[model samples]
Target: MYRAGGTVTGERDAQPGVSRVRRLGTHLPPVARAPGEARAFVADALRSWHVPEDKACDIVLAASELVTNAFEHGSGGIALRMRFTGDCLLLEVRDSDPGDPVLHRPGPRSVRGRGLALIQALSSAWGHRRGGDGKWVWAEFQLA
Candidate 1:
């Protein structure tokens, strides 16, 4: 149980008709010398058993953004994972940053600082969790 705002929180309750795994996880190194390596890890792990190219490409892009975030801002390397619930894939990136990421909408001419926003727009859903030594940022995308 988790307590916040003086209230205790219970574990997630599965819906009566839903059979789903809402969580996925991985424990990655604190620092990846090359973000591409991290991207490859996610791409390979979550690649389609049948549709390798398309899924691998998407995972690579998202993973690149996530691992970059960890390498650039977080204290340690990224821990990445993905889950398949129905037709959705949730990609999670965990890092050693206690503070959550701040996503923003940048102006059209802005040259940087919009990666998370892009992730948010591309994915079906996304969020983060704070851990004792770090934070996790996750995004969910639907498979067509």
Candidate 2:
């Protein structure tokens, strides 16, 4: 289960319902493998939840971006959690760094820095919060 501060402890599932599915994973920092790992993790969860193909694709991409951002700016290990609440799929990535991410406009010649932008454009809603030990970046996608 996840603590009030977004720290993931024991993993558990609630009663079978819209909120029946919950999954969490932790990865070491440097996050070189996080994006791909995140894609697989979210894809598997969404598939189990019977999410539609299109929405699942979007969630995977958004999850990659969130995880990538955490690795880039966050310190120590990172944690990822996914859950269903009503008709929305909520994905959260927590890192030990307390720095808040900033959305910036990249230059024309920029080869990167578009992660958050893609997330903002694709997800129904997204935000971040400072946790007890670090911060968690989250994005939500409509499942209906």
User: For residues 1-144, could you state the per-residue lDDT of candidate 1 as single tens digits?
Assistant: 111111111122278875333443445555555366666555544543233466557666877888788878886656766666546777777778788798978899998788888787677788889866998788877776
TM-score of each: 0.70, 0.81
For all predictions, the C-alpha RMSD in Å is 9.4, 5.1
Clashing pairs in 2: 1-10
Model 2 RMSD, rounded to 1 decimal: 5.1
Candidate 2 lDDT by residue in tens digits, 1-144: 112222333244655554444555555345578677777767876787788899889999998888888778876777888777648878888877788878878998999999989888888999899898899899888877
- Best TM-score goes to which candidate? 2
Question: Residue 16 lDDT in model 2?
Answer: 57
Q: What is the lDDT of residue 70 in candidate 1?
A: 81
lDDT of each: 0.65, 0.76
What lDDT, from 0 to 1, does candidate 2 have? 0.76
Off by over 4 Å in 2: 1-20, 23-29
User: Could you tell me the TM-score of candidate 1?
Assistant: 0.70
